[model samples]
Target: MATEVTTLVEETSAVKPNGGVTLPIYMDNHATTPVDPRVLEEMLPYFTGKFGNAASRNHSFGWAGEEAVETARERIAKLIGATTKEIVFTSGATESDNLAIKGVAEMYREKGNHIITAVTEHKAVLDTCKRLEKYGYRVTYLPVQKDGLVDLDDLKRAIDDKTILVTIMAANNEIGVLQPIAEIGKLCHEKGVIFHTDATQAVGKVPIDVAKQNLDLVSISAHKMYGPKGVGALYVRRKSPRVQLSPIIDGGGHERGMRSGTLNVAAGIPSACRVAR
Candidate 1:
């Protein structure tokens, strides 16, 4: 049976209001974006004949599915200045933030039980720190300056021998303020702590070079960049102090055992589109 679809979004750039402003306008792009037509066009094949489980190893169907994911990954890697192997797909930035924080905390528990982040960080990060506190881990929620940027001096003072990870966001989703990610990454590297940035609002809009910034892990979302929802990726540095994470999920061991789930074949390609092939 063929199901009819509704066209909710206006394809035209914008409709003018009654001499006020654009009508039917989506004001907060920081939160999300309508999927681009190009992305949708690219993803149509996978839902039909190309449909297959990426985890299936013996069939041509599986091969097609895996190729789509890999191609999508290559585009994601290129957008963020990362290697294809460094990208780990996830449900979204929230999960990416959790994986980066909790993964580091659990994997290096013997080394340290302390983590640091800013007061202005995304809830995924700040709340994860709070949860860690309940688990007997120490957390430092650094204060932001009047301009809404993390205080570098405060951050330096907060880093102690036990601090294992530092999670900060590259851009503020609410205020649209840019953080000093480069400086923070350099500082974290000097202090020998892992640096994770929620670049959901920054990746496609700005130039973020993981190596140049000395960043260890970066969280990226597709919906924020005119792609679809329900998918995201994390960049975990592989060398120059390869970052390790303890898997929060356990099953088929997809996503290199970090996040285990049947890869969202259709949603993934478009979700990571523009960021994907």
Candidate 2:
């Protein structure tokens, strides 16, 4: 069955542009996937005719672009059991992970200076935690079991009154090990610590209901889910101790002031559209 799936993917992934690679990375789903032709069709017009800044609020072109972007947010949100208002568009999962981690660290600095995460987390996460460590924020890197699962007891012990956030990956990109994200989230909530999951490798492959899982923030990547690269989102919980974050790329106060800059109308819309379809 795996061989058959790989063969099918190879057949469709034939666009080796400029003698580059066209692999779908079947062996490792962390890389990228070919954009669906249908998704491309849905996105073409924005690049040509309807291209306008979503931040612009006084014209029809801008309105159309803004509408498309919002629709895409709704599509992406619905897939992961979140609301449209909770979605904050980003460059990709790396940025999402950074925003979720550093954002929490900065916003909650007065409340806590400690964070807990598994050693098996993605570099996007590990690196972000490292950046925080430089600023004197204490981080606890919980060791995983030999079987590549995080020890829940270790995580429970790591969380202290000074712990602000606990980030764990939903799935290991390298070894395909699924982590206990729901359990981790439940534990964090019990201790009044925010829970973040880098769900880039698990969003499309597994079921994720933010409410059910009690996730405070979720990092997602477009390319990891068979969509275009360079675009993703961070799901920030609203209400019930609403998650707050300091913007990393501050500019035009876009994306609820969590992420700033002009929205990528064409690519952003189809990336989420592909996953929803």
Candidate 3:
């Protein structure tokens, strides 16, 4: 049976006053975008034609779905200049931020319990750091300069022998200011501290090379690009030892055991494709 799929297409409607028409203008791209007709056409088959559970490994249908998911992972990794193995799919940036901070903090608590971050971070990152503090981990919330940038000297002053990690966002979500990530990374490297950045906004808008920046970990969201919602990725540099973190949720081993769940193969494919572009 063939399934019918309807792609929502939005057309500009003119306003009429006294039988006179006024031009319609689209000025809300920041809120949302019109769905691309081609994407809808490409996704129709997955919804009806070849619907299968990606986590079901007992049948060929499942294998096909699983393969698509892996291919998507590769695409996402390529876009970020990472290996597919380093990408961990999550619900979104919020989850990605939680995993990166909580995961590393739990894993490295024995090494040190101190984590440094900026005051201007998103609530996702800010709240996660606060939660860690409740668990006896010391957190340093460095204030940013008037220009919405963290002072490199403050970052240096915050570091101590007990400091295990430093997390900063690549750019400010509200103010649109880019951080001095490369400089921060260098300082962390010299001090043997792990550096992580929430690159949700910076990933597509600017260039990011993990190696050049000396980044140990980075967080990115899919929908920030042209991809679907509810999916994002974390980049953990393999050259560094795998980030150790306690799982917030216990389940079957997945996402290299850092995150666990049945993978969303459909969202993964398009998310990766969008990032690659």
Counting clashing residue pairs in each candidate, in order, gives 1, 0, 1
Worst 10 residues of 2 by lDDT: 268-277
What would the per-residue lDDT of candidate 1 be over residues 168-192, giving only the tens digit for each residue?
A: 8999999978899999999999889
Q: What TM-scores do the predictions have?
A: 0.91, 0.89, 0.86
The best candidate in terms of lDDT:
2
**Residue 55 of candidate 3: its Cα lDDT?**
76
Per-residue lDDT of candidate 3, residues 1-277 (tens digit): 1232222222224354644645565555433334444544555666665576777889987887777678777877777678888888788888989988888888888899999999999899999999888899999999988889999999989999999999999977778799999999899989999899999878767888787888888998766666667878788777765555667766987877878887776674454356347
Q: Write the residue-wise lDDT of candidate 2 on 109-224 in tens digits.
A: 99989999988888999999998999999999999999999999999889898999999999888888999889998988888999999998888788888999999999988877
Candidate 2: residue 276 lDDT (0-100): 49
Rank ordering of all candidates by lDDT, starting from the highest? 2, 1, 3
Candidate lDDT values, in order: 0.86, 0.87, 0.78
Predicted structure 1, TM vs. truth: 0.91
